[model samples]
Target: MISGLLTGLSLIIAIGAQNAYVLKIGLHKKYVFPVCTICFLGDFLLIWCGVFGIGAIIQKFPIFLDTFRYGGAAFLFVYGLLSLKNFFKSSGSLVAGNTVSLPSLSKVLLTCLGFTFLNPHVYLDTMILLGSIASAYGEPGKYFFSMGACLGSFLWFYSLGYG
Candidate 1:
């Protein structure tokens, strides 16, 4: 459990797309709970699937991986364009208490989903890497490892969201 927790933290502590978006939303204090929940659940599901050896099944489907890779890249490109436009328009800063309009719930949720699922690195870290590590522990230890990973995810997201 301790090793799992440490491993999970080590993997997730780094800043990435998902963490950046979460921190942005959190700083703005909009949909923080739901956004954080989505992140936590997403991590939990991926880590659990990895620990259970689903990564092997996913590896068998190269076409599926390729499709997701291209699709995610396209989405990210568009999102970047929009963000760049917004930046040029002087929409808002990352500072708290800005009066910028909050995005609609559906839009926010969709964006959060995009950030969560569209990042291929999420799968690589949580599913492939973590899963491979957990496999070394066998059945019961794998479960504990997954639980620790999940806990680490929850702590990180909640802290990033609310702190």
Candidate 2:
């Protein structure tokens, strides 16, 4: 359990679209609970895919991997530049007031889906890497590992949203 938890946390600690979005929503304090819940649920879904042998299908397609990798990298670089631009444009504190106007639940869900699906790393982490690792532990261990992964996602989004 401990190892599984650590593996899950460690795998997701690196910066990515979902994490960036979560942090953004957290700092903005807008639609926080829903946004965070979406993140957690998204993570859970992807982790399940990885743990359930779906990653093997993804692994078989080298061209797909390459395409996704390059595209995701481009998206990250652009997203980073945009963030930096936003940071530089505003003089006021990012923490000062709620800059993010809360949107409707539908919009929030769409945004979460966008944050999740627009990038490929989510698939890589949840399916390729986490799935591979979880499969190593057999059936019961796989479940434990998945539980840990789910918990990690929950904790991370909860912290990002509430902190």
Candidate 3:
């Protein structure tokens, strides 16, 4: 359990796009509760799936992974372009409401989902890698590891969202 807790913390502590988006929404105090809940639940689901050996099934089907990879790439490209356009249109100020309009809750939620689901790294890290590691501990240990990982995810997202 301690090992799992430490490993989970180490893995999720990194500041990635998902973390950044959570922090931004948190700072703005918009949809923080829902966003954080989504992130935590998403991580929990993925980690549990991993612990149950879904990673092996996914590995067996390379085509499924390929499809998602290409789709994720396209989605990321379009999102990047949109972000670039927004950046250019803005006056480049930290002030929230001066020249930039906050996005609608639905838009924000969709974007949050995109950031969460479209990133292949999330699956690789949480599912494949973490799952493999948890497997080394046997059945009961895997559950403990998964719980620790889930706790780590909840703690991290809540901290980022509400801190």
Better of 1 and 2 by TM-score: 1
For model 2, the superposed segments whose C-alpha errors exceed 4 Å read 15-17, 96-109
TM-score result, candidate 1: 0.93
Best by lDDT: 1
Report model 3's TM-score to 2 decimal places. Answer: 0.90
In order of lDDT, best first, we have 1, 3, 2
Writing each residue's lDDT as its tens digit, candidate 1 over 1-163 gives: 8788889999998987788888888888989999999999998998988888787687797776787688888888898898899899995687777777678989988899998888878888898899999999997898898888888999999999888
What's each prediction's TM-score? 0.93, 0.81, 0.90
Model 2 Cα lDDT, one tens digit per residue, 1-163: 5666788888777766687677767787777888888788888998898888886676686777777777777777787797789789877554626564646768767867767765787877787788888889997999898898888878878887788
Name the 10 consecutive residues with the lowest summed lDDT in model 3. Answer: 93-102
Candidate 3 stretches with Cα past 4 Å from truth are 93-99
Q: What is the per-residue lDDT of model 3 for residues 23-45, given as tens digits with 9 covering 90 to 100? A: 87877777899999888888888
Model with the higher lDDT, candidate 2 or 3: 3
